[model samples]
Target chain A: MSVQPGPATALSMSSATPAIEAVELSKRYGEVQALDGLSIAVAPGTVFGLLGPNGAGKSTAVKILTTLARPDSGSATVAGIDVLRRPDAVRRAIGVVTQRSGVDPVATGRENLQLIGRIHGMRGGEIKARTAELLDRFELTEHADRPARTYSGGMQRKLDVAMGLIHRPQVLFLDEPTTGLDPEARSQMWQEISRLTGAEGLSILLTTHYLEEADQLAAELAIVDRGRIVAAGTPEQLKAGLRGDAIVVELADEVATAKAATALRAVPGAREITADGHTARARVDAGASALPAVLAGLEQAGVLVASATVARPSLDDVYLRHAGRAFAAAHEQEVA
Target chain B: MTTMVSHSGYLTVRAVRALVRQPVFLIITLMQPIIWLLLFGQLFSKVVEIPGFESTGSYLDYLTPGVVVMTALFSSGWSGMGFILDMERGVMDRLLSSPVRRGAMISGPLAYQAVTTVIQSVVIFVVGWLAGARFPGGLVGIVVTIVAAILLASALASFSNALALLLRSQESVIGVAQLLVLPLVFLSSAVMDIRVAPEWIQTVSTYNPVDWAATASRIVLSADPDWYEVLWRLGGLLAVAVVVGWLATRAFRTYQRAA
Candidate 1:
């Protein structure tokens, strides 16, 4: 958890040439630009999170990389194969669990897996064995013959991920794998995903809106806003990129926040500041070191600081640093 | 491609197995055709029995082919319902996202529908036989008729599935298909003689591929096999199948693009 500034072996994530790569990708649906010059590189053996809100081109990027949709002007490669000219190869190399569950509800869990395996060109014996193995791995063996419609949300998500991994593709694309699940189920899925990447060494690219989901699961991350990747790095790096800890000052009024922010800017190592409504936030290299200076300065400026706290930066802070708004605010707008 | 077809064959078997799991589907599959045969057969019997019909045989014999075609039409037209079911259940998208050939994924549902269509056609044919309907062209003709019905129905189902993709709503798709199916059946030479109909009806029948299928099916059932007439009707139905199948493929592409 101790992520240092840079070149700290405290973080094991190695940024490499990316198993999945997009170059100048752009997609337009009539007047709407679904993706605008979006580019990303996913390392070969790490969990890369495409962190964004809904309709921020997360799924669009997945489709392009998974060979489901062609980008209007960009190029992409998956597992070393060109997605445009050799999409079948890309399809062969990556497994995808879309935002929507792909498990056939009427069919048994085992049947769904077997059918998917067959579609991927596996014969009966192979499909049967793999289906059984996946069902067992997902802890659905007892219910393998039961209709998927009977599964709980967590069980269905597990089945979905198992179906994707049935063919053992090198890269896995999970688009919002836990969107509608309850908190407990979402946490279980996070554990399952962590186990997969850790045990199997599979490169996973997951798209998620949950900041904690990304923080808990992703080794590397990208913050996409308005169809562009505004920032990319490991969760720790992105968090650390904002430098040290964050000082959140809740003021009595919007004017107080403005006044408090202006005074706090004079403190050394207060790298950036953001003001929203009656709250102002400042990021500094050392959060503990900068707090007292900020408090004294705000007191001198006669700004009524209702409350203030200093804590380690989060991905939210990283998002705010890159996009100049709270991550939750952007999420709210995207949802709207 | 052979391997692909073999893989699709596996999918078809799985689809059939899934249907069998419900058990009621088996009954409805047979029950639907019988209802069509008896209801439409008796309803239009008096009108169809009028003299100077397409054949010298009883109107029941003449109505047999139309009922078979109707069964096939109904079977195929409802094929898109499977797409909706799969979509809602997340099956279709799952298959689509896999390395499976797109054609194979589509053919799974289509093949299941076709196999069941053949079963329904045979059941209808047997019921007709019990009612004194005979295949004048013998066993070859009966087998050919059944095969033709299956293929024709499968092609129709492909078109239905494409429509389903475009609409993506079950009520609208099922509603539009229901509205279109019986009208096309009634407008064609299915239950009545095409020649005795009004000039407009005759002209319309000429363009109704369902009419072509019905007429071809009739040629095999009634005595005096007019091989040339049979060839013409079969050719027209096949042409319709090919065109509609292509449209279904295009529709599938659009759906994939949207996805």
Candidate 2:
């Protein structure tokens, strides 16, 4: 089921043209279909997250939107410029920080910024001032003169984002921005990204596999699975769409999983049950009231429950409800 | 049009600055040309004494132009490494996604090779002169020789860039470059006079761009410079450079499509 944006987003959606829009975009790479009739619309001045597992066509979508690759069919636009017909114009309007760090390692951070600034047609004086401002803003001023290769991974990632923002682009694309970062750096990047949308009024299209990242930063998000949007809405809406809390029971062994699944099914108000290895998960209307019945049912079935807990639905639960599988399992399957 | 030119210029500066930052890499690249000028100049010194062999004075004098052309050829053949580096580092995709003219990606490195060829040719000239080789054609001759070298290097660099864009692998680019360079150097009159070369090699050398460059440079550096021979070969090299540069620029589309 396609969930519509909440009233807040709906009001904005009706008032302003979308900052980024793609309709039924599909792309094929020989035998593999990277994108299949995927579509999305991002409101201006908001962070739109494409949340997915690895190999979910997020990068491919970014590539096409940023004009780095052509889609086999469908149409997209960034800042109202058609991506296919006027890619250069689209390029002029959007900033893209790809999954890979795009900073030139041989050049100093300052040099890298200046070069990109020049490519974006910024004048010498403008480039110098902007470069300084970005370097200072990203906390890279101390190391601005050093070759980017010399910087730490977090620092290099910051430079990449700084480079993307050199031209004051209307929209920014951050593809897996914090994928390789440590916990500290990831949070730091999150703060920086949050500030970007608020003060600058820049629309951001961020692709992330991190559920927390999407929940924390995205004003609106679309969960992509197998090259299609499985669920799309505000994080709260997607979670609320499930209509209850999630009950997770940890069993003693893999052998008990089947018994636990059958047991959990008998408990009233529990539905959408899935069991794998030593864990059995289900959705219930009210976790506090439903937990004792669930555990009692499992006990009657002679299923040994190591522990059980119930919590409000997270993006993980929303993903399970929509995608019909766990996010981690999908990621593992992709890696395998 | 102006944007294209300016982008190309900025990218060229980027390419050159990258090389300049790594002085060790720059010196190592020049080592080959310097070795050929010194060692090969001595090794082939007696070749001019052979029957039907021609020389302005010594073998080193004849070999100086050969060294300049060979340096240009060998160095330019590896220009693809830079493109491959950019591709691997994700810089190429970043630049492609920017409002960058695709032509600049090709021309920038080609221009860098041209600048490198000039520096390399001058270095070889000085080394040859220090090792007792005399160029009677003087400063004008050296300038013309450097121009020929630049043309040859541009053509090779463009071809290398095209191969890099198409192959997108270091081993493949290296394999193809090695496959092309040695034959091109030996098949041309880089170290020996064509008069002493086999009939088929002379025929092959007549069509080789390397031969055009080497022969043109040698003629200009001789006591009696052949303006006609120099101009036509330089013109031929220019045409080849333009055609190959265009192909290299088009290769960006192939890369983008595949990407």
Candidate 3:
């Protein structure tokens, strides 16, 4: 089989550049500002993950970039076409796997592919051949003739991705692709996505609330909050750029939190002290070395220490520093 | 050598194939017209002496054409319910996300409804024939009547689907559809002739495309074929179909814009 040319091929030969770019894009739905002057650029042949809690406008951003929805203000270009002005061209250049899977449950898996291919103006033979290939790619060759409703959740999500890839678009937008899948299914989907991106060298923009999925799949990610981007960087950089490993010191009494924060600030290599309930967390250069001093400082201040643990800085830590709350805690609040 | 066959009729063929897949639905589509024929045919048969009524041999003959047209209207009016299902199920969104032309998306479902209308029309005609409504015009007349019913029904379905797009709510679309259909059927000469009806009713029927469709179909099916009447009624229905279809196009544009 012939390999699909990626961004590198075009870049190496000429001046073709970023596949998708949003310059301070904004969109509002009545009273709710879904996206607030968000800006990001995705290089050709790269996976750019939009990571945020639910209702953080990650899906909104994807919708604008894929040309399904337009931004109220600001400009977006996808695959060299203005999203709002030339949506038809943008539609031609990109494939979208929406948060809601769009596969027809009544139609057979193969029929679904053929139907999509035909709509894309593929000839009968071409659509048939491509349908066979997509079925094989998603490992649905056996179930190709069966109605899609009969497939497992993982199988359906896989087919969703395969459908997007059928036309070999320059850019692909996957909005929460593995959202409802079990861990095993999610992992399988991750592998498939990785293999396809690598093989075809396609630029992908994926929005996922799963932090680790962002870390594992995206070379770079933008952490979004409310209706704007809070931070943007590689997963390693975002984690490494934090002051230190998070050391959580739960005080014996809730009142010690404020006192402990004051006391911990004086300790060497500690930064960004925040107290919540009975727990006082501080970022330090080395949690192991700083723990004894932290304990000593708290003792001097007559603060009772109940528990203490030191660990490597994670995306959760970065999120906490940026958003003023733990990632999981913020996610729960959003869900509530 | 897999030479492609660009079936000019492929769109309609695919539409029929899709409609047939839903067997329960197909049966329901066929039954609505049959029910109207049986119920209204018997009721209006005895009440035909209300003066000014053209003496038809039986009420069934007068009602058959109207029932066929009403069935088409009823079937067409609910075409958008499928669209709502498509929307909720993500199938419609998937199609939009593809490189498919906007017209084709509208055509697929509309074509399917048209084909279903034809099948239902055929079933109604056969039942009417078995009930002693002799076809004086033979095969040509039957074919013309069926074609008129399909076109008129498909056109109405297109407009309804467009309204469905505008409303974007299944309950609202279905409610509005139900409210509009019964009135349109009643106001037209579907159950009784204009001559026997009150003056106000005759004036209102002039504006009802369902009346136009029924009149056209009845003209062709009746023993005395008034070519002028048939042509004029068919033309009026065609015009309504064009206008309603245009509204649907505007609805499509509105839907895409909002999305």
Candidate 4:
């Protein structure tokens, strides 16, 4: 009979505002359909991830939204400004740390930050203070005076993130921020990115292929595939929506996929079974209890099994369920 | 307007800082002008004795302005390299995404080369003086030489940056610019006296922008201070620089879509 009112006040203050929104955004690069009917809405002051494999139009969407490239069709708005109509205003309201490190390698980290600050029309004293604050926060204060090329990959990436914040933009886009970093560096970047979530009216639109990264950082996210949003929701909601355990079967050969799915479906409480390219996945009520029955049904159908696994539902399983293929395989296909 | 000016200032400062960080670049930049002044200056010392060649007190004075222009040519040839580096490093995309004036980005690298060319021209002039070169117009001639070098460097720098933005590849830009500059240098009076050069070469030199700079500076330093010729040639170099600089700014559109 009652509802939470305190948090709703904060949201209601600007209920009409979506920090970034795209509607049926489509782009074709020569023959490649980089983005097709891609759409998303990001809440203000939250980290929103565009989670997808490489070449899934994640970067394309970002390029359009950032005004670096134009979509063949469709429209978008960033920070309440229409990207297509007033790109310069959108540019001023956002900061971007692209997949590639954007720090000027030849200039000192301080110089790189100062350049962006000046570009944003910050006064000299303001740029100096902001640059100093960012360097200290990013742990680059010790090496702030050195050419960014001399810094390690992690350091340079941190500098890039800092550079993006030089103007205190309303929105920040980190496109695959941890792509080229080592594990240690990736986690460090993750920590740095995590610190910026949910504060100061600053919203973030992070594009990443790492499942865990999206899970850890974004409060809500969209799974893009073939330039379309396959699924979009809170991480937990998306995973929870795929109710039941994921039973993965590793097959010896690409054979009898339809037969295997039929057999798994015959088992009680098994649903949404699929056999694709030496792998069969099924959903069951209880992984431990349903495993033996599913296996027996497959064996009855004379389907040879290399191995099988029963695990809790995950984004990977959700992606598999929706896309009818593994995410890694689709990514590989794009790369090839 | 203030944002544009400040952004331009910041970008120029950033470019200069990059050059300062690389001490070897400064040394290598000087090497071209020094070599022309010392080796080429001495090797061609007897050119003054040619029947039509005016008797400049020494060959160094005759070669000083040419070497200065050549140095500007060589340095400006790689002006596009800075844009290539920024693109490769993703810095240009970062700037493009910001509110910075796009023209400021184009002019930053060009201004760095222009400043370096002027400063190096002074060094080349001092070296020429020590090596027995005589300046007929004294300080005015040195100022004219620096101004000429600045214009030449600015024009070449704009052309190189335009190529960088248009081609978006470092290797192609280097190959094209180097090829283009060689012909321009050979056709001009940078090395040989125009009178001693073939008649076609002499005629071509008159129309060459590089020759405009060389002639403007050479006249200022020669005993015959032909104000009209110097002013017109200097005006020509400035006009070319402005046109090429405007083209360089327009090239940013290609870059924006390129990403």
Best-to-worst ranking by DockQ: 2, 4, 1, 3
lDDT by residue (B43-148, candidate 3, tens digit) is 6677667767664557787777788888888878888887787788776677676656667666667667766777787898898878766667777788888778
lDDT for each residue of candidate 4 in B117-201, tens digit (9 for 90 to 100): 8778888888888988889888998898889888888888888888888888898679756888888888987876788888999
lDDT per prediction? Answer: 0.81, 0.90, 0.81, 0.86
The candidate, 1 or 4, that scores higher on DockQ is 4
Interface RMSD of each: 1.9, 0.8, 2.6, 1.2
Q: Candidate 4, residues A36-88: lDDT per residue as tens digits? A: 99999999888999988889999999999999998889999998999999999
Q: After superposing candidate 3, which stretches have Cα over 4 Å from the reference?
A: A1-11, A14-16, A249-270, A274-280, A292-308, B1-15
Can you tell me the CAPRI class of model 3?
A: acceptable
Chain A TM-score relative to the true structure, per candidate:
0.87, 0.94, 0.90, 0.92
Best by lDDT: 2
Model 1 Cα shift for residue B188 (angstroms): 1.1
Off by over 4 Å in 2: A1-15, A255-259, A296-304
lDDT of 3 at A156: 93
Candidate 2 residues A1-336, lDDT tens each? 998788888556533788999998999998999999889999988999999998888888999999988898999988888999999999899898988788999899999999989999999789999999999999999999999999999999999999999999999999999988999999999999999999988999999999999999999999998888989999989987988889999898789888899998899888999998777999988899998899899999998888898888899998887888888888878878
- Give the per-residue lDDT digits (tens) of candidate 2, residues B75-188: 888889898998888898789889988878777888889888888888888888999999998999999989988988888888888888899888866875688888998999
Measured with DockQ on alpha carbons, how good is candidate 1? 0.57
